[model samples]
Target: MLDFSFGAVAMGHLVACVFFLKFWSRTRDELFAVFAAAFALFALEQVLIAWAGLPKEEQTWFYLLRLLAFLLIIAAVLRKNRRWS
Candidate 1:
């Protein structure tokens, strides 16, 4: 059973993801694309957590999803900076 809080958070992430996607479409910025991907991953992670009825994210493999999202953001930043330099 998905909790209200989790559902709300997931929805928020999805909305942000869409906004980022729109920005990416307008500017064609890789950073915006990466951000959108991260947000979507976050939403997926939350839904998976709720559906699986997981107790703690840290204790489960689901944590990897969040880690991957953060890593993607970091990689995007690094790549962008490298391109600028």
Candidate 2:
């Protein structure tokens, strides 16, 4: 059951990546590029999570990819909102 859930999540991430990449291509926006990269990383992380087969207690390392993806999103938002003098 867990495998099925992981597969579904990975597929969702892949779809999101594709959409983001398409938007980036159309808009030439750094924010969309960052989003696409983040979603791609999320898809990779999901695969790694399934591949590792580690117990919940030992899954900390796998979470780092998620952290990096979130950080990329945060950085992109901040960059977009920064005021230009």
Candidate 3:
């Protein structure tokens, strides 16, 4: 079940990356750029989490990356809405 959850999160991050890239290409909006960066960072977090069996010590770093990614997503959403409104 843990493996499945990790796989699902990884896939979600990858999909979000693809959509962010598409948005960037289509609109060239800075918000999309932010999203793309955030998603890429999120993807890194997913990768680290998925492969965390390397060393138990690295789990903390993965969690930190996830937190940073979350902050980026929040920042991007706020910026996007502020621009639109």
Candidate 4:
């Protein structure tokens, strides 16, 4: 059901976070560090969504976490590209 899907999504986020952290460690890259943080936030957001059991209408706040994660990714990319120029 929905629970299963949420759990799977959370696990996927966690796995992504771990990989990003590993890449950050190996390369000492700020982009990887930002990515790891974003994924970690996403994983936490999924856990909160699954556990809170909030109604769809009230889930807007939860989605902000996702928005923030994406914004972080965008900001990092912009910063990187600007630095290269």
lDDT of 2 at 74: 98
Alpha-carbon lDDT, every model: 0.92, 0.93, 0.78, 0.93
The model with the greatest TM-score is 4
Candidate 1 — which residues are off by over 4 angstroms? 57-59
Error of 4 at 28 (Å): 0.6
Instruction: Kindly report which residue stretches of model 4 are placed more than 4 angstroms away from their true locations once superposed.
Output: none
RMSD of each: 1.9, 1.3, 2.9, 0.8
Model 3 has an lDDT value of: 0.78
Residue pairs whose backbone atoms clash in candidate 3:
none
Candidates sorted on TM-score, descending: 4, 2, 1, 3
Across residues 1-85, which tens digit of lDDT does each residue of candidate 3 receive? 8767877887887788889889889989877777777777777876777677656675786777768877887887888888889
Query: What is the Cα-based TM-score of model 1?
Result: 0.91
Superposed on all Cα atoms, model 2 deviates from the true structure by an RMSD in Å of: 1.3
Q: What TM-score would each prediction reach against the true structure? A: 0.91, 0.93, 0.69, 0.94
**TM-score, cand. 4:** 0.94
Model 3 stretches astray by more than 4 angstroms: 54-58, 77-85
Worst 10 residues of 3 by lDDT: 49-58
